[model samples]
Target: MQSTLSGRGFRPGDVHTLIVPLFHVTGLNTIMPTAFHQGATLVVTAQQSPRDILALIERHCATTFFAVPTTMILLAQTPGVEQHDVSSLRLIAYSGAPMPLRAIQRLRELFPGVRLHNFFGLTETTSVTTVLPDEQALVRPESVGLPPPGIELKIVDDHGDPLPANAIGELLVKGPSVVKSYHNRPEASAEVIVDGWLHTGDTASLDEEGYLFLQGRKKERVIVAGENVYPVEVENVLTRHPAVAEVAVIGRPHAILGEVVKALSCCDPTPTLTSGR
Candidate 1:
């Protein structure tokens, strides 16, 4: 994806303006090549402060930027970020974690005209899936998105049979971008990449329109009296209480139901629990 992005006309020819940290997978595989392949400048940074990144963008007139969700948030909130001449930034690729709706909206407000793409993948997969174009980033925030051109996706049940579309199941990915095996670990390779499928262990469902919606991890679900309970659902509900700042729900052992829901909550700064008392 980086190589393909680098070939665009907007990229500078200097080759030193493409900012990246060389030790990471994105730097080694995506950031560095995008610059080298395009003959664009690569900008190496010692630190990742929002101010520093914006300065590089202004100084180099960089046409593209790629970063994780956390960094993006920090940049948007930075004091002087808006003062920089960042109009040259045409493309911004973000991954590492799902961009929450709030963060996505904030980025749109910050960069009104820049293109944004969300990519999803593990290190072993070498970044196989990408959500392309700025539209999908806002319209379908949940989907990690369609597999990159060469990648294939399989949603299957516990028995390995392909489940119907829109059904929740384990996600399996296979493609040229993925690593065939772990370094010096045959057993680990066998456990993950079995028979051409890399079991993601994440629970997700597809919509009728084929957009994927990720639920929490498969292991996070609890079986209570044969009914499946997702802690996130309960937590989401409890968070609506004005006094609640944050909450976590877990499955607790129960003599009758085998398992029961237990909730732990952190109250707001000025909590008022007098009504319940």
Candidate 2:
């Protein structure tokens, strides 16, 4: 899967520096496997700070770097990063979160010889669901790129019926890399996998050229301070209150956390509680 999905992005003898967790899908399925399959060198290091990362790259003569957007931002915007000789880098790939335009531009300036790529995937897909190649990295930054060869994608509305291109809807994926079920999670497996298609909970759309663009999430989950918060779980607890009659939970933007859960509710009319009483 990694060999075919990676295409020309990886080659024999290329040096890869491991920054993302090895246990995660991006590292385990995509980075490590693809590197070994292509006979590339893998450098396992724990240095995370911007200066440390820059030093590691220069020391190892690393050709590839894969990390989350936050880490990439720090690396690209580090003070005096240009002083380091990082010319050996051939590829810089990121996933697991969105990259800001400011960081992307800075990275372009920081490494003109490196190819910047952004991929999108879930742990369920075992990584590399879509890869925004270097050519489309800036052209369609909003799009997660076309699915690799042999992957099938479909967008469906609330009713589970398919929607045409450019229509935002729930994203469904089917491919060899997709897991059939979850471990010891029958209910979760049933909800996520249907007729061989993995219901990715994320809301997305495809353009006329088949480039995918994620809109948001359609499921009950939100990310607050890097924590997964299920709105249903919160709503379940909130309904236990005597004064609460109804509630609707969702996620709102947060400057630092990326997203925070917000719940709207209506109190019981007969037992209305006054604020600050």
Candidate 3:
């Protein structure tokens, strides 16, 4: 059988370690299908420990591991991670959430030979929509890369008018991968899927080269005095600091600005947002 998965560079019969939950789209729709299509072996472990996962990768000589940012950070910062021979890992794909630039650099340090890929998609999109290649991973760390084959992506304004390149707007996707509707909720299905395009509800932009950049969710945008502020951008910058472990930016009520950026953060030992800077 011919494979439509051409752009992806996984070996013909490589081994993969399933880090994400099997019920999740990353594992269910993406990893499982890919492994079956490529005729590769998949390593599954009940316990989700850094040590156990790493050990399995070594035992299976897994060439690929698909996980989110937190798992990536934990695996990289695992106690005595060097003790595990994860040199077999060639491709590290991350999705679900934003991978801070600092973490990306750490991954590079931990696995020099591996190619890091940032994937962007929702459960509604089935799995992956665009992929930031290793070549441009560092160069455009924020970008989620261009669409894969058989997918059509575009940015549109509030009126559903298509926006030009680099203009931030709602990202709409049209392709075979997109679901026709929700199981029973016709109202929800109608609201989200309009005119054959899936309104992703994500505030994003496409660059001149067709690279996709996701700012955040449209409803999550914090407008401070008529200026748009994306929480993810602020969160990315916050995570760059050594002390910060996690951060969540939100839009809070403000009398003047309509909304203001409110960042809730946590750090190991203690957290002082002002002191570190």
lDDT string for model 3 (5-29, tens) is 5445666788888778889887888
In candidate 2, what are the lDDT values of residues 154-210, reduced to their tens digit?
999879999998887789999998998999999999998999999998878888888
In model 1, where is the ten-residue run with the lowest total lDDT? Answer: 3-12
Ranking by lDDT: 3, 2, 1
TM-score, per-candidate, Cα-based: 0.78, 0.78, 0.91
For TM-score, the strongest prediction is 3
Any runs in candidate 2 off by more than 4 Å, and if so which? Answer: 2-8, 220-277
Clashes of each: 11, 0, 0
Query: What tens-digit string does per-residue lDDT give for candidate 1 at 164-259?
Result: 887877878887877888889999899989877788887776666656666657898777998877775576567556577557889999999989
Q: All candidates' lDDT scores?
A: 0.70, 0.81, 0.84
Once model 2 is optimally superposed onto the true structure by TM-score, how far is the C-alpha of residue 22 displaced, in angstroms? 0.7
Clashing pairs in 2: none
